[model samples]
Target: MKKPASAVPAKKRSFMEFMKRREGQRGLVIVLFMAIPLLLLAVFTYIPFLKMVQFSFFDMKYIGDRTFVGLQNYIDVFKRDDIFGALFVSVYYMGGAVVQLALALFFASLMVFKVKGDAFFKGAMFFPYLICGIAVGFIFKFFYARGFVLDSLLQLLGMEMEDIPMWLQDQRINNISLAATSVWRYTGQNMILFLGAMMSVDSDLYEAASLDGANKWHQFRYIILPSIKSIVVLNLILSISGSLSAFEPPYVITNGTMGTGTYFVIMNRLAHENQKVGLACAMAIVLLAIIILCTVAQKLFFKYVFDDGTADESKAAVRRRKMEEKAAKKAAKSGAMAQSSVSGKGGQK
Candidate 1:
């Protein structure tokens, strides 16, 4: 069934007409837009994750004969004290995340108002976040090294050198020191995120609250907190997940010694140094499960805390409601004034 030349033009015209239609254009656009990202996600994220899951079940190295050990790797992940105990180290980081979030919120709130040298302060705060994590690690390593930057500063404050405990050596304070580095590097990032969220809040709400005699604290509590709840939740989940997978500061600063071996550092060591790839994979899976559980738990906690009837509403919805209420009140007051004027005119007559 060969088509003639004229018939081929007719077919081409029909195809062009189809392409001109909205549905065809939409479908074409969707396919074009989604194809690359989906392909990349499959290739990079999903495929690798599935491969890791499969690898968790086998006894293997980076390159070697694989033995089908089934659940032995999983069992060994739990049985090994060194591997499992590393999870406790994450508690320090988690604590640091709390401090980080608090300081971020405080600074963000301050930045929302007019302040002196606002741009300079913001840049100074955010500069750490811009620095390379490895570079920041090395910087702090030297900063915290005995008789270095931090020690020199403390000594200038009339504190004896002997009175100053080793920042990265004393087991009691080394973990805290490492955790503080994480806080230093990340607090600025959290502050910037919080500031963006706060800046997006309706300014009208603040003005109205001010007219209603709401102080800064009251305005922050009732209006800002409610409006930015979603951002707060998002930050909390990310911070918690980051805490669970902390690696850089400890890895670069301390090399995971002095009771500072977090789960990721231990996993790295096992997979690379010890060549326990399967055990490392199992540990990864376990960490993934813990992170998922923590995320779910956090979502549930936030849901419960915000279980007011308006919990499902977004920040925009809250702002819209307030605007509507304000409009309605203004209309009522105008109507009352009109009625009062008519009543006075009637009495005069």
Candidate 2:
């Protein structure tokens, strides 16, 4: 049986129509599957964000009557300079974050060297990351107390109290001590992240470099670093965010005091002492904005500066070539049609 002429065009649907029909059904199924979680996220996460913004505007009195004071709550913290302590504490935490990331990267690189007991060592390194933040805070507090008390062996070596700074008490030394503990605790996790990235690098690159008379340092600088450049940005963003919002370590160590710990950071100051919820929220939002800006800046910087230059430029050149080819094809098709029309007219005559 011959099919109707109208059915031929209907059967040959446009590519866009085919895609829309296929994707529409698939998208409906995906949306259905995702709907419950989306609803939960909207209710929990987005609702809280809206509430925080709402609270940023008002100062509620203990009495039932609520008065909207506009941006006064935000302004008051700056006017009093009480927020400076929070900023200080945040910077203190950031110091720890840097130390942690550096040590983690270093140790992770060592693991990638295929040392003996690699699995055991990697596990040991990552063990601390599994611990609760509050627990880490308490454990380190004890370590700080025993600072120079381990002088039995040190005494034999003629080392004394002068060698160990009063870690918990003296404000100047305390923050640094906190940073040291943080590095010790967090380095393992970072090591794992870096090690995984390092593993993905092509082994042939190392072999080629070795054959070219490149030393360990030369290979690391030229090949290893370039390959893991993306990981650096990832770790940097994580480190920066962790440092900025740091709350647990300083809060637990200082027991909410002013002088000796990361209580100087805004999270501690706002939560424990000043109770400036509005100011704290403002500080948090500002910190979040800074982190986002820095992340974007890092991404842009890495894409341009640290990228495998040849790959990006080659892809761009390829795209240009394809565009030129397409244009040439279209022009050739038009010329062929014109020639065919002229021939047809001569035959008709």
Candidate 3:
């Protein structure tokens, strides 16, 4: 008996055939294009991250003989109040990130309307982001120095130098002042991102909404927000992670002193200053896990509420299905009636 068609195995392509096809050729070229980046990503990014994870489980310094002490480093990380305290500083940074994104969105919305001198305004706003992190640190240090630029500016505004609080030395608001520097630097960058996402939204939708007598707020809530949801979520994740990894401003300006020590700053101090490499790695891993967890939670939340938590199927598809089912039932009913009528007529005759 001959084998059925379904029983036959598909022929595998030979190496020559794979190289000869246009698609295969293009894929080979694309693979080559991406090869260097993949290599660099693996070498620099993945390798180091893996090393950090490995180091977290062992008792080792940067230059000492390694000893396997599983989970002790992680335990040690949690035992220290100072480390926990430093991590708490990240809350200020996270708060700043929220305010930063808000300001960015507000400005982005304004710029989208294309006011006069928008080009100049956009450039001016974005200029701060272009400044180097170290440069911003140095600039803000001087700006915040006592009886310096900030105090002078306040004096010019009719506030006495004595009345103005010290920007960096004051423990009550030093972290906030540092966080403000970060906000100033990154808000414009975020605004540009929001602007780009907003611009990509279909203009026809906006016109249609306008025709429907929808005001700007209504259009933004209904159309703009939905369209830019992915970008906004992406920025939120970035902002959260950035806040957790904050270092430069506090590190450079305050040197992690005066209650301004952040998680990363404290980690740096441990790894380099105290030579607690394993403990630092453990802290890094813990922080990484926290960020990953938050990101995943946010993703799940956004996924669940996508499309206003309406029916899973598109409205058009749902309507079409209902129509088809109704038509089928109507046809079946008509057929049954006709058959019964014929049977009754035959019996009567």
Candidate 4:
């Protein structure tokens, strides 16, 4: 059977109409503009990510023959207790990140209400972030060294050497100290980000809330937090992933020694020092999966909890009630029909 000419041209005509639309033309232009960056991302990010995933499935050193090992590499990651123990170090970093965010939020909230020397304080706070990671590590190493900067400052505050504890030597405290360095480095950045988010919020809203007898805390809770929820959530996600992959402070200061080895540091050592590249790749893949899972979980959690899924919930509840009512009515009707049929049959009998 021959296709109708009209039908054949319909798809083409629709496409032509779409192309003729101004919105379609603008979308095409936007896509054209995005192509280069998309290509670069695919080449740089996605290609490497795929290669890492492939590497996870193989047992191969950097120089040796690659053999398919399937899940062995992944299994190896869990079999060793060190990998899990290394993850425990992330707790310290995560705790520090939370503290950093809290401090940042506190400072940003206070500073949003017009503070004296704001620029100076902002600059001072942000300066550490501007410093190179290695330089910061070196600086802190010296600062935390015995009878050095931190110790000296503490001594001036009337703490004796006997009373003071070693910052980097003690396993119990070294991870905390290292994590603090990250907090010191990142807190200002988070504060600035939060301050920016807060500033963008409608000033009129705050004024109106205040006019309605809302206090600072009330205003913050109802207005500022809601406005900056996305930013806060984003920072938290980044903080979580970054904490899990912490490497620089421990690498530069403790060199992954004294229980300061984070997941990435351990992976780094496994890959380079131990030359167990496949195992390291598997570890990396696992960590990446964990990070992705955490991010997805946070996004879904926020969407459900804060993104007002109430409409959907209410709609679902209404649908369920309607379904139940319909089923009950149907059942009652069926029962009545069956009873009438039985009575008719009996009467006939």
Candidate 5:
């Protein structure tokens, strides 16, 4: 006797049939086309990284061929006394990143609150990000070159134009000016990211908190803070990486000078002045290690911060399932009522 149709392994057959279906076949072709660029990207990007690792083991010279140097280049960065000043400048650069990130978060919070003219405000805030870093550097350079603000302030204080402090001329003022320019350009991008993250948070949570007599500050502290914790971690990582790898702003403004330049950052020191390819690779590796450590620290920090928190993956899943179940029941009940009405009409007729 022949077996029933349902007893056959129809699932595997159906999957294979679906693969051959015309609609899915076009999607498969499109997917392959999209994947080609991704394959090229992985090869070009990761192959260079691997080559850099190999180069870091060799003593690269300005002239002729390179010799094997092992870890000597890395040792120089840590052990050299001359680099101490640059290291100090790296701390100052960190200060710049912190200022940029904090201001970005503050502005993002304001934008998330649905303030008046929010669209225009967001566009104005983010306009700087559209301009090139070099352009920003030169624009600020011109702004400082004018000496108008300084001269005016000095004049108000009963002093002449001669008494005004030159912005780019002095080392301390130059660093601060570079940092301010960097912040002006990059903070908008960060603010947009934070705003996007804030907008995704559950509105119901905010409502619940409000119902519990939580004010705006309390809601922010209890609800908004916990919801956007992941974004904060992400921004921290970006800020740290950007701080460690800072180059364009100082390079443009100060022309790579010692005190005035951001080339004090390890990556900058390795690339421009030192011209040590091996050491630069080693620096890249060190920076990579630092980033990893920071990510781990952030994970721990988030765990600690969220210790008293309410959000959980399993709880969210349960809530979603219950909502879906309720919707399904309501749909089934409506269908049953419609069918009953049709049967009653047929009997009456």
Candidate 6:
């Protein structure tokens, strides 16, 4: 006949009680909200990254017998001249990034003030960034083709046909030409970012600077730059990282030919065309390491440069503090003079 109530009912009752509580409901909601994202991240990002790292250690193709070739792939990454040469090609892109940032900052600084056709100019600049990278690559491909848009424009300036250099074919100028495409495409983006940062700065500070006889250049140097230092640093980091991973311009425009292959393009060829998946994985890992190092170095440099006596204090912070101190001293001096004048009037009375 019916045995004594088992522990199962007791446990079920407790669980139901817990579920009925607000904390339990909140925990359940949290878990439900986090589950999908965490699952997807695990499956897509973490798993793939771990698999790539694993593949880096094995000498195996996408569909081939697996063989462990510990560290040889990594060694080859440095030993191979093509892979190393791709790194050198990145230098041109890095230089282009510097120029891109300068142009972006200059335009952003100018446009932040009242300028005619500012909206149209901003849209014209940022429009390229909104376009697909592949589309941009193709557009520049035709733009750089011999006797194309660029050449036609040059020819209109009384330049002879024989003097015009090949934009994509010549080894000396091809990389520069490709890098210029990147600059043109991305400069607008940086300008927009800098503009956003500049817009956030207090207008009163600008007025104060103007009152102090600061010219446009001085305002830009002492006020705008110090205020937007964070954004400037962020843009620099992104630009440097993008430069290292530049692929679309060189890959689509030149097909990584005539010495335009970047690290990514070379890695892509190694993985797909050559079927050296393991070595490609190693190269990817190496590139990741290099990017991390560069990012850390940049952060440290900014930190050191921006830090004054106080921890993490920026130049803008220092300037603001000095202004506050000066204002306080002026107020205190005025108050003390008023008090002394009142005392003298009382004595005469």
User: What do the candidate models score in CA lDDT, each in turn?
Assistant: 0.84, 0.67, 0.83, 0.84, 0.69, 0.86
Cα displacement (angstroms), candidate 2, residue 175, comes to 1.2
Pick by lDDT: which candidate is best? 6
Quote the positional error of residue 265 for candidate 2 in Å.
Answer: 7.1
lDDT of 2 by residue, 1-349 (tens): 4766333455556655766877999999999999999999999988877766776676642234546778886676556444656556667667887877777767766665658999898888789888997899888777677443333445567877577656777777676766666677778888887877777666666687789999877766765565566677788778877766666776787664545334235554564465656555555555666789978997888667565362323657645644665676577877775445333322221
Say which candidate scores most in TM-score.
Answer: 6
- Runs of candidate 4 exceeding 4 Å displacement: 1-39, 306-349
Candidate 2: TM-score? Answer: 0.73
- Between which residue pairs do clashes occur in model 4? none
Lowest lDDT block of 10, candidate 4: 340-349
How many residue-pair clashes does candidate 3 contain?
0
- For residues 209-234, what per-residue lDDT tens digits would candidate 6 score against the true structure? 79989899987876677656777888
What is the TM-score of each predicted model, taking all chains together?
0.81, 0.73, 0.78, 0.77, 0.70, 0.83
Instruction: Give the Å error, residue 255, model 5.
Output: 1.7
Candidate 5 per-residue lDDT over residues 217-293, each given as its tens digit: 87666556655666777777777767666777777777657475443354566655667777777667665676788
The per-candidate count of clashes, in order, stands at 0, 6, 0, 0, 0, 0
How many collisions between residues are there in candidate 6? 0
Off by over 4 Å in 5: 1-35, 81-84, 146-164, 202-213, 263-275, 306-349
Give the candidate order by descending TM-score: 6, 1, 3, 4, 2, 5
Which residue pairs in candidate 6 have backbone atoms (N, alpha carbon, C) closer than 3 angstroms, thus clashing?
none
